[model samples]
Target: MKLLLLRNFVFTILQSGTVVGLIPFLIVEPKLNDMLTQQLKISHYLGMLIFTLGFFMMLICIRSFAIDGKGTLSPADPTKRLVIKGLYKFSRNPMYIGVLTILMGETIFFKSYQLLIYLLLIFIAFNIFIILVEEPRLRRDFGKEYLDYCKKVERWG
Candidate 1:
């Protein structure tokens, strides 16, 4: 159980780091100094708070997936059981929400227009992926249970 959790945590770190770390750093870091002007001071604090919240939310959701659903967030090893507890009870796609929140926080913190564009693109892509691919697959796999969960839960929160 410990090993499985460790593995899941590693995967989460890798996935989150790539999406919320490396990409934004590469794209936004160059303009960071200029962006972090005196005027945007409040934004910096707000962004950090949002980012921290998102990070913790993701961790909680990931742990719930591993413990309750018996799987990781990776598509290669998605949760076997439907995760309907924790943040999942509130949002059908809290992980995505978490990621998007992190990205939005990054955009605000860095004051990067380019990162904002990237965030929009990612949001659209995630929406399409969830609607077209994930929902259908979940419907097929979990049948009525997933549909019922959808009825109760908001897709984003």
Candidate 2:
């Protein structure tokens, strides 16, 4: 129990720190709208539009998929039910994809190298969480059932 709590705490700290670290870079630091080209605002808007569409799809998929399977946002302790419907049918990690898309959108909008790097760090953390914390637990709990699901579903789509 203590180990689980510690792990959860550490995950929380990393996630919170990533956000806090990005806040200054996104809001306080002024970046040229576009360093490479003069059309920074146009690119920003384009990125925002693409991100918004992806985010919206993710939200819809989450509601349609996650709630049915009783999945939790955290990988620390997940529900017993295996979710392989809706977005899960398409992508094993829609929520993470959504989050990463948002981060990428922010990076494009802000044109901040620092925030982009932070976003990459967050992706690394999430990748580790999925590989180390989530998948093993699922394999342990679900066994052949999960293996079958894995056979059908791709990790990301």
Give the Cα RMSD of candidate 1. Answer: 1.9
How well is each residue in 6-101 modelled by candidate 2, as lDDT tens digits? 544464345533464446345535544345355557867976886686566556544543456554445554554787776787877876787777
* Steric clash count of candidate 1: 0
User: Clashes in model 2: which pairs?
Assistant: none
lDDT of 1 by residue, 27-89 (tens): 977776777655758889889988988888888888988899898888777889999998898
- The per-model lDDT (C-alpha) reads 0.87, 0.66
Q: Report lDDT (Cα) of residue 43, candidate 2.
A: 69
TM-score: model 2 vs. ground truth? 0.70
**Candidate 2 — what's its lDDT?**
0.66
Top candidate when judged by TM-score against the true structure: 1
Least accurate stretch of 10 residues (summed lDDT) in model 1? 31-40
Query: How accurate locally is residue 84 in candidate 2, as Cα lDDT from 0 to 100?
Result: 75
TM-score of each: 0.91, 0.70
Q: What is the C-alpha local distance difference test score of candidate 1?
A: 0.87
Cα error, candidate 1, residue 157 (Å): 4.0
The window of 10 residues in a row where model 2 has the poorest summed lDDT is 16-25
